[model samples]
Target: MEIDFAEYQLSSQLRGHEDDARGICVCDNTGIATSSRDRTIRFWTLDESNKRDYTLSKILLGHTSFVGPLAWVQPNDEFPEGGIVSGGMDTLVLVWNLVTGEKIQTLKGHKLQVTGIALDGSDIVSTSVDCTLRRWRKGQQVEEWEAHKAAIQAIIRLPSGELVTGSSDMTLKLWKGKSCIQTFLGHTDTIRGLAVMPGLGILSASHDGSIRLWTLSGELLMEMVGHTSIVYSVDAHSSGLIVSSSEDCFAKIWKDGVCVQSIEHPGCVWDAKFLENGDIVTACSDGIVRIWTTCHDKVADAVELDSFASQLSQYKCSRKRVGGLKLEDLPGLEALQIAGTSEGQTKVVREGDNGVAYSWNMSEQKWDKIGEVVDGPDDNMKHPVLDGVQYDYVFDVDIGDGQPIRKLPCNRSDNPYDVADKWLIKENLPLSFREQIVEFILQNTGQKNFTPDPSFRDPYTGSSAYIPGAPSKSSGVSKPTYKHIPKGPLCRLDVTSGVSPFQRLLGERHSFSFSAECNRHDFSVLCVLVRRNSSDWSASSGFDVIPVTGELT
Candidate 1:
């Protein structure tokens, strides 16, 4: 079905957050409410003189770390002007009085960052990176349980009062009260964003670079593709219009699962939303919140539009530069025939005197042209140096034209996801770029098909290449150091990080490569025991395959 709406145009930019805006909520009547990495929640109100403009009204601070998720409540006796609920990296959920902008309650229990929040009447439901869901009533914990085996990243409540949770496990679960009734599985990566389509179903945006529509019954209705990178957030308007934002620096609008418009930005778009009146609002990594409107009267003037266009052009100009690279040695465009392991994975092909960059759109199974490739291009040294640290790769990240070039150091022994997360936090960059930076590290470092460490998941990455006998990170308990004892004599063996006595998987997420070259008897008996919290796993290792026979203490 075609969306019968006017084309969205730039309306106005709202600025106040000291850092990148991460969340936006337009449900309140006072104005727009947004959460940011600045550890503050800001409220905006419309200007009486310039009706299309919004001015800062209030700033609420309570969380000690970056705030991300938001929820709104209607006015009641407890909150005369409605209320605002927010979650943050401080692992606390706060409820604020919309009118006074004062924190009314602070709920604490999560051991990790809170990823999602929803208001259930007078109760508040929240999901966290701790892989659990907690419910609170009257500012007191009412119920809590393990929601997923991995970190829960997104959550939404259906009109029928059922709850849906999306997790780093690459799956969505439908819940009623506290029981999971259905599980939706299709996304190959972390599920980051969730929203209801009202009459249609539910919509999910994922790190897999695709948006999916699924019925409550667990049937995938449609998979929408077009964003060339990690999709951070998605929203739906009652008119059946869907809008999504991505690390690709584009806010794409989709109608019937087909991309109808792509609104470009100078930096990553962290979140997007639709107002009841059909206007669109986008929170961006550039420390600006932009409002797009289909109504001509609300659009910005000619001079403002031109200024935005010039800024976008300037960004593209500085984003890519051919440097220290020989064109003849570059891979041709035919190199795109083989699929990339992840979405937004960049590939540079030799194009005449320059090497053009292309981003893999996994959902479309095609490569989309990004600008020219940048960085060292090809630093094939034994080890790259960054700030006195030797690394397998060091990537130069171009955030903007005037900013200093940021160096992202990576070692083959390090997990790309962990590296990206730490770098983003250290540099105070938007958290939405975690997946994008991971892809960049994987592409430039040539670490494809890397296994992900399931233990410490903050919105998971990598493939399902599990190393046998490795401890699951989500267990939340201490892991036992397992040793392999052979019946013969003890031999000195080279040991790396994860390498056990004889042979073991070294790195956390790296591929396990074991070479057993000891004096082989006709048959050798290998006993492996892993004990933790009164549970034990015993395995028999043979030439054929290591199989877990039973449990022992």
Candidate 2:
């Protein structure tokens, strides 16, 4: 299917886990179960107020270690109300009655940590770090056998009733009843994830950062490589799409061996599963269970509006740290009011007598004023102030468009020449404009320089500039300097007696010509000159060396 993967947005975030969420599974149409390193399993249901959002229904606590895998039992005669089974690092598998929030059974036998579990018909099959696979029926071990030489990381049963297990030994073994049928070998590292793709084949994800497709009989079909770190989980939907989560902090959707969509996570994604409606739920190391879906209707307009408000609040908090005015601090502000228009736009207003309104601008990615300027010229004009000082006739200019505008402060009562020079240095104005603009501001302000600073530092580049009549510490070197030179026009040096001809032929040659202005700075410059032939110089590349307090113009 041609799905617009880009249309997939975060539908909701399930926040309850106290530690890393290790596994996630869709229990039914509206329910999801997540296991965590916090030693608890959380049950969440679609929020009735907003179906896109999930609220914690219950927390099932019993496991003493990290709960890593979970499987749902289909409702049958044996499990009339159908429960969930979880395996974890404590080497214990616990079966829980989902409705009652009670542990129904604790199936134990593994000598080490249980890594994975799967439901085969009415029986539960689990793999462990003890390098063994055990079959249990109704809380009792029915059968057990050696599955791998090393820890078996994952296991799944095929539609043909054959069991397949992947291990740290870097091989997958297909088992029929108690005898091994075929072993598929390709991964160079531990196989961390396994899934059965119905009519397609078996898909295996490994610590080698690769996913391999194989037939039921053990023939490798295709190798998918994209993740830079270990892949932890792989799950397939009935729609012929496969999703894999990895330690690379992303979950990827693959179709016919091609990765179609990638969902980025803030932390390592431990598990991802598709819900009944094809919505995806991911478990992450950030202790968040996030849902991503192409279904936009899942998230109601009100919920999305609240999310936008939350983002704006976070932005306001960030602005407070950077010394910017808040919306409440605006002119005639009382309470901040926001509304959504019918045209899918957001409008925000400062509620008061002289309140201002702003409309969301999607194109500019910011809020734009809604009404025309009504204030008179005198009211619209604003003087620049900085550090308790104001500058006359100096207006603030917004150099960073769409970003917070910064004010340039200077002493207004001070000599105009002195303030202008300091402001030019602080604003990092070009050296070429120092004479014209400084003199113009001084003449207009009608002030004379009583005391002028001779040495000033450029704020942006941190470069020091010295005035013409300034005293210098050394002769001919008034300030730190930087020079950019073109290294070209190659000339072959004569090979001396002790010099090897082969060395001269293989060595690179470049000549440096320094100007009389070079002795001002203490720095080093390394240049590389490439020659296409003995006489033809192809290209040259180099960089200028500047002092720590100096910058190149």
lDDT by residue (tens digit), candidate 2, 297-408: 7653567647645644554433321112233434332222332222324232334323344555555555556653234535522432232122345434343324344343
Model 2 has an lDDT value of: 0.68
Candidate 1 regions exceeding 4 Å error are: 1-5, 324-553
Assess every candidate by TM-score.
0.61, 0.55
User: Where does the lowest 10-residue lDDT sum fall in candidate 2?
Assistant: 520-529
| Model 1 pairs in collision | 455-473, 498-506
lDDT, candidate 1, residue 286?
Answer: 75
List model 1 lDDT by residue over 127-179, tens digit each: 99999999999999999999999999999999899999999999999999999
Q: Candidate 1 lDDT (Cα, whole model)?
A: 0.76
- Quote the positional error of residue 451 for candidate 1 in Å: 41
For all the candidates, what are their Cα RMSDs to the real structure?
19.7, 21.3
Candidate-wise lDDT, in order: 0.76, 0.68
